[model samples]
Target: VTQRLCNQIAGKLNSRPRKRLGFFTPQEYIHAHL
Candidate 1:
């Protein structure tokens, strides 16, 4: 159970940057915007 929870949390963290940029990776969006 703990391992499953950790995996879910890790996945969320890994995807957070993309979500923050409206589904674009943060670096990709920033470069495009600039």
Candidate 2:
């Protein structure tokens, strides 16, 4: 895939919060816990 496509996917994944992660985005979870 193109770099642009990968970046888009990564952005979406990172922007959306997950219920399993206590409704926090992955980045937020990492920052709070790590």
Candidate 3:
């Protein structure tokens, strides 16, 4: 249950694009920075 919920949150954070990130998802933003 805890693991499942954490997976859901991680999925959203990795997949959702943000305006503050110039419309890039968290994963993309991290790669772009590095």
Candidate 4:
């Protein structure tokens, strides 16, 4: 896959909220920890 496509996929995954984090996006959860 192209680098652009890889980045797009990662962005989408990171932006999705997960039940594991009280419905917070992965990025949001990470930023909170930091």
For all candidates in order, the CA lDDT equals: 0.76, 0.96, 0.92, 0.94
- TM-score per candidate, in order? 0.46, 0.78, 0.66, 0.78
For model 3, how does the per-residue alpha-carbon lDDT over 1-34 read when each residue is reduced to its tens digit?
6999999988988799999999999889999999
- Local accuracy of candidate 1 as per-residue lDDT tens digits, 1-34: 6999999988777656676688876566878899
Ranking by lDDT: 2, 4, 3, 1
- Candidate maximizing TM-score: 2
Superposed model 3: Cα runs more than 4 Å off: none
Error of 1 at 8 (Å): 0.2
Top candidate when judged by lDDT against the true structure: 2
Clashing pairs in 4: none
Q: Report the Cα lDDT for candidate 3.
A: 0.92
Backbone clashes, candidate 4: 0
What lDDT score is found at residue 34 in candidate 2? Answer: 80
Q: Can you list the residue pairs that collide in candidate 1?
A: none
Q: Which ten residues in a row have the lowest lDDT in candidate 4?
A: 22-31
Clashes found in each candidate (C-alpha, N, C closer than 3 A): 0, 0, 0, 0
Model 1 residue 13 distance off true place after TM-score fit, in angstroms: 0.2
